[model samples]
Target: MELSVEQAAELRELVNSRDVPADIATRGRIVLWSGKGRRRKDIAELLGVSLPTVDRWKARYAERGLAGLEGERPGGAREQMPARVRSRVIALTRMTPPAGTGLSHWSTRELAKYLARTENIVVSWHYIARIWREESLKPHRSGTFKISKDPAFAEKAADVIGLYLAPPGGAVVLSIDEKTQIQALDRTQPVLPVAFAATGKRTADYVRHGTTNLFAALNVTTGEVLGECRPTRNGKDFLTFLKKAVKPHAGKDIHVVLDNLSTHTTWEVKEWLSKNPHVHFHFTPVGSSWLNQIEIWFGILTRQSIRRGTFSSVHVLVKQIRDYINSWNTTAKPFTWTATAGEVLAKARLVATNMKKIVNNNSN
Candidate 1:
């Protein structure tokens, strides 16, 4: 419902009026907020009343207008929600959803259905949702974590972390990585630029022209990025990028931190390493790209360039990537790594222990 100017003014007057009963004034405010598109539950919360009270006030106002608030409150009081049932709802939300439901998280509607079936209760999903909101119960999202299974996890992590915490003197430390198969997608419609009132919008459909692979090197100390976009992602391309990245710091000792990608460990890569005796490689543990700072730079690149950009062709995409690299070089700051290897190992070990306990309990 939308309020007419006169109706809104009258409600505002009631809300401000000293003569009106507090209850009547509150109902007036509820109706006013509802007319401005506020929900019943929100009105109830702001007025310190129950959902049923909000509904009654709105219903009465809709039916009898101002005259409705003239009498005693329309449904005197609400029966309390069953405390035990509320506890059951909360407990279920904390637990994993039933396997047969094919749901990893509990939706309000799903919980209401489950509760109704199991406990012989008739309750609205809205009510359940309100309860969950009050309790801050969101079982729908999960946090992510990874524990590398590499045997040299400890040694590798310490090596990389040592580079971050205490880098070798007079050496160029570079965190390098490749973002492969980046598509040049043109939106079917033009992008609407963001404004103060709204975020930018884009068409869901797009035209794919071509793809390129981005090879990037982040200078850990200086915060400079050396990048190239190649048509292929292979040992040969990586080698070419490596040669280019090292040219500026040719005489200085170079230490590169990288993931354990197949290309990074190829015979050709090894031969290149052998040729450049001054250059050293510190590979992060398997499945632990987070240990490399370049991954953080890649995230920034994706968000600022690739994610929202509309590219007509691979050439355009490459140009955008180079441009973004140039812009970043002017303002980039060295990425910080605060957690020590010991702290990281401890957290990972704790996760592993918790996971083991869960598995053991489930098996029994």
Candidate 2:
């Protein structure tokens, strides 16, 4: 074989360069040796390859320069998964596993096995996983939802949400709720402080000291919390807290947002509302207490103060609760409520539609 100066230089570089593929470099060496008047038998021996491999590369280089040595052999590409198989995998992923399999959801391996057993379609778990990734499917995770059954859900939600979005001028809007039966638990051993690369640790076992109830009233405009720890969360305690919450804005009309708890609608509370005509009550829908902003503050209190605190007695727990409330009031900012009444009603209608479909399917 004869070669141009450029081809000779390129072949030399290919054989010497580390980045080129080993087989391509070997072929470059064969071409170079052939160009230098070397015998086929000697080239095979020097390169540790059979005579047929040597002849094949030499012929390929002769017919197509450089390009012939770069690509795979004919039919070297992987075969794609069949369309029917991919569709089957996606369909099965959207359903529960058959009974007696004891699978609440489908795993990649289990789905592959089930397909092989029942449909006689053999495929690897990797293929199914790839299909899931392409389709954005996750069978191993689940989320929770609740649809309010309150007949007046829309009306009640709108009333409370309206108060949050736009409170009446010169009237104080307060969201009130009671966190009942908050237990004071003392860890059996002292908690270990957090260290480098380790989280703080505490013993799982604890001593039950006692329980207390917290009545909290959150001012909507100001985000300040007026809270009291009481022994019980009965109607009387709620009335006392309400009076205290209302005392500051004396003479101004007060609009209170609260859940539809028995304590809130008791006879005494109704009588108090009648006597104090300036005060108005707006109740959140049943099972939809999340509408009240005070519930959001209570969640903050639990996560920040009560969840990990080691209270030896009820008195200690009460003091901690009071301290957190005082600290919160010092730098309070109102929670932003973005959802409008129409948006909430639209979502509720959607959830209700889904529930009705599920119920109809089950009945059939």
Candidate 3:
């Protein structure tokens, strides 16, 4: 009926130690509950033990203190799971199920059923799930990686990354790109503004007003974003925006990081570049848009401003974009490129190696 501080503390410690047998830990928990003035019948029901089993452990602790709790069992101790079972669980997770088994991937329930029928080993789905977690095995999920195949990938990626890390003194580094065909969309119904208890809500359907292209340049030295909404995304419009962007910074040399779009390499653009020798251009590798940090700024703008905004017409949409860019300029910090060119190239090579293995396996 009563417990000294030492006795209560010992029982609590044993209940928390995972090294002990489950039955022994349950016993310790039962005694701790009984110490809290729980009846023998209530402790037995709470722990899923019979009244007599509860009485046995409580009596043991009362008589011999902590020593009586370690009474002898049929086996000295329960053994850990065999290595063979663990390995089989991991191997099955990494493979596709058999053709006749009606399973594309191994689910925990299906695995347990398979083991019961074929291996004569019975385990609950929960036990199999524990093993899967311990081994970090997931049979139903996958990921994708791309290795750019641009013949000039190495040099192009190096040049872009170099501009980000170190630029010529007194020269402005600009990341320039265009986000085209941005729809001027109006929600079908009125939106509910956000409140403390819930998030803002918008109609799933929208009315299309039209589309416009956004040509933007991000100043790498200062986080200022300059953007123009153009009716066309042709070389002529691109050149026009380029001239406007470079006009103020005319006296200083500028290095621009961009993608290899046809409009950017047109004869007019090329001739203009030749005329302004101080204006240098470095292209990011095909399929490696992540090397350019301006795209990151665009993503932020889309999420915070454009995605949720409801525009009634092309003019309103353009004005909204211009306003967002102007506001973004007030608090712009240069995006940092922490990875070295060597590290990126090494990762690309690893991706290439993995892709080759996948291709070869598919061929076989």
Candidate 4:
């Protein structure tokens, strides 16, 4: 049941009055309760207030009503940035930070300080952090930031990506990339299985001795991996791997996708390529290593097989990597391209914009 204006006002007055004693405050609650059920006598007894006094309060309340209620306190620090200012702050962060700032991106503290100084808008670091999280612009460390500097980057990239997207009929599109000097690491202490609690314990210890290089070419459509391993992934080693990867697809126009590495286009390798008219080379765009599906496979290999591995020598590392590849090929499947060409182009445009900003900044 809704409260009568009189009863609400009576309760409010009792709650707010400085002279009202605790017992009377108790009576005010009773008044509301009794008024709710039309139980005046019970309310009077419960509050220890005279029934007549309750009636008078209730009558006064019916007249004064909700206006007699309390109000909020007026003093507090204002919000750091209003909605509009917060959006502006995000816009500034997305752009490059000021030159000579010795920082690639703005830390929340730096951004907050900048806002306060430049816009005369004061905001707490907590709020700034919240905004970054909300905007999905939090700074993170990723290996992808390391980029290749290929001058013929775009042309090379288009060729490679095209092979994957539209390979010549009855021809193979192989994406080749090299992971050089991978160190084999073994855990210092033995790893224990969770099931063994008290006994039947076994321990194994290991160390990282040295590194070896891997050159792999993957058939994008077939999930077939063909390549070689060498102590040094120099020009010779790269070319050797290339020949091995290409020989199987000989007599046809085989599209070989690789990054623009110094050794890849050496005179020796080029001479070999010229002799094999049927073989073709495609290069990934500069700075966009993510275009290669093999890169994704490399990440999986590192996480699942390479990391924390202790190989006694380069021979052992090479063997392990080869074993992993064989195992993978046995059950490997082609990666489905859910990202359409149009979507990729849209993202590429954004990346181009960011790169232009960087180049412009460098020029200035």
lDDT of candidate 4? 0.64
| For model 3, the run of ten residues with the poorest summed lDDT | 188-197
Writing each residue's lDDT as its tens digit, candidate 4 over 73-120 gives: 247644345566666666665544554454445666678778788878
| Model 1: lowest-lDDT 10 consecutive positions | 188-197
Q: Per-model C-alpha lDDT, please?
A: 0.75, 0.78, 0.73, 0.64
Which tens-of-lDDT digit does each residue in 219-271 have in candidate 3?
98887888999888999999998888888798999898888788999999999
Model 3 residue-pair collision total:
0
TM-score of 1: 0.59
- Model 3 residue 3 CA deviation (Å) reads 51
Whole-model alpha-carbon lDDT for candidate 2: 0.78
Residue 255 deviation, candidate 4, in Å? 0.4
Q: Is candidate 1 or candidate 2 better by lDDT?
A: 2
Leading candidate by TM-score: 1
- Runs of candidate 4 exceeding 4 Å displacement: 1-157, 189-206, 351-364
Model 3 pairs in collision: none
Best by lDDT: 2
TM-score of 3: 0.57
**Sequence-dependent TM-score of model 4:** 0.54
